[model samples]
Structure formats: C-alpha cells, structure tokens
Target: MAQSNKYQTGDQVKVRVDSPSHHYRTPTYIQGKTGVVVAICGRYRNPESLGHGGDGMPEQLLYRVSFAQNSVWDRYRGPSGDKILVDIYEHWLDPVGV
Candidate 1:
C-alpha cells in the first residue's frame, strides 16, 4: 500500500536549503523561503536521479506551496499580495512553528 501524505493542505512549511552538488529540480531562488502547502501533487519518480540518466524510483510526494512575493524577496517591489506557487517535494520541506 502507498504511504499517506506527510503534510496537509494549509500546513506551514519552510523549504530546506539542500545545495547538492548535482542536478537538482528545486529552484535556488525559493530555497530557505517559507510558505503554505496549498495542494498535494501526489508522488513521482525522483527527478534528480533521472537527470543524470539513472532510473528514477522511490517516488516522492509533491506539493503546491504558495509564498507571498514579499516574503520570498527582501527587495520585492511588486504588489503586496502577489504570491508565487511552486511544486516542491517532501524532503525539501520543514514544518514551521505555529
């Protein structure tokens, strides 16, 4: 049987700063940013492994996180409520304290 999702919708989480010296899917700009899990995109084969021609296995949970533009950028000059949604994996997330 498949495992249940570790996070739920509306869960506050922080993206971990895992700067592996290899092909990665998470964008550098979103690293260390805090956001809310808006949706769970299910699981899929690990892409980082497939990037280097390895057989992608052990699928991971993907989540749609929404982050306020201002919260993500220190010098953000856009709309106050503008947000960016990103698809992130389970391993890249850290639960934020209430």
Candidate 2:
C-alpha cells in the first residue's frame, strides 16, 4: 500500500515509538513531548544510521521537529528563549489532537 503525502511544515505532531528496544534518532526524553514541525526534507526508505545499510522507499517524508529547550533539558543553562531541533522521519509523527 502507498502512503499519502499530506504533511506540512509548522504542523503539530506527536512522535510515537514503534520499537522500544532499538536505538533511534529521537531522544528518549522527547519521545512523548509535543513539538512543532519546522521543515520537510522529502522521503527516504532508511533511517539516518551510518552503519545501517540504506535501503527502503524513496518517498519517505523527513521533518524537522522543534521543541523548547526547557522541555528537552533539565539543566539547560540557555534561556527559555532557545529551542531544540531534531530531524526525524515522518513515521514518527501523528496528528497532535488534544
């Protein structure tokens, strides 16, 4: 089955973990944190692991997730004015409906 390409930057999304045991690009602290989308980097079949052979679809949408610095770090010395950005795959996101 083909997935629909319907996501946009600035969209609110929730990152869900499909695998608990495997290491992921998403930090564990931000797994359940809600963030806003910053950018879209197209689609790819593989995750960004230098060791993992790149093999998958060419249509995976990549997105930049932005979270507040205070939300991610416990002892962040930076002012609340700062934020963090993480590049994640689209599969990690879902519509954040409260």
- On lDDT, the leading prediction is 1
Model 1 stretches with alpha carbons more than 4 Å out: none
TM-score between candidate 2 and the true structure: 0.73
Per-residue accuracy of model 2 over 1-98 as CA lDDT, tens digit each: 66665567778888785664544566667787778998877666655442255455454578888988897778989889899888877767888874
TM-score, per-candidate, Cα-based:
0.92, 0.73
Query: In model 1, which residue pairs have backbone atoms overlapping below 3 Å?
Result: none
Model 2 lDDT on a 0 to 1 scale = 0.73
Residue 6 of model 1 has an lDDT of 84
Q: Cα deviation of 74 in candidate 1 (Å)?
A: 1.8
Predictions in order: lDDT: 0.92, 0.73
Residue pairs whose backbone atoms clash in candidate 2: 43-60, 44-60, 45-57
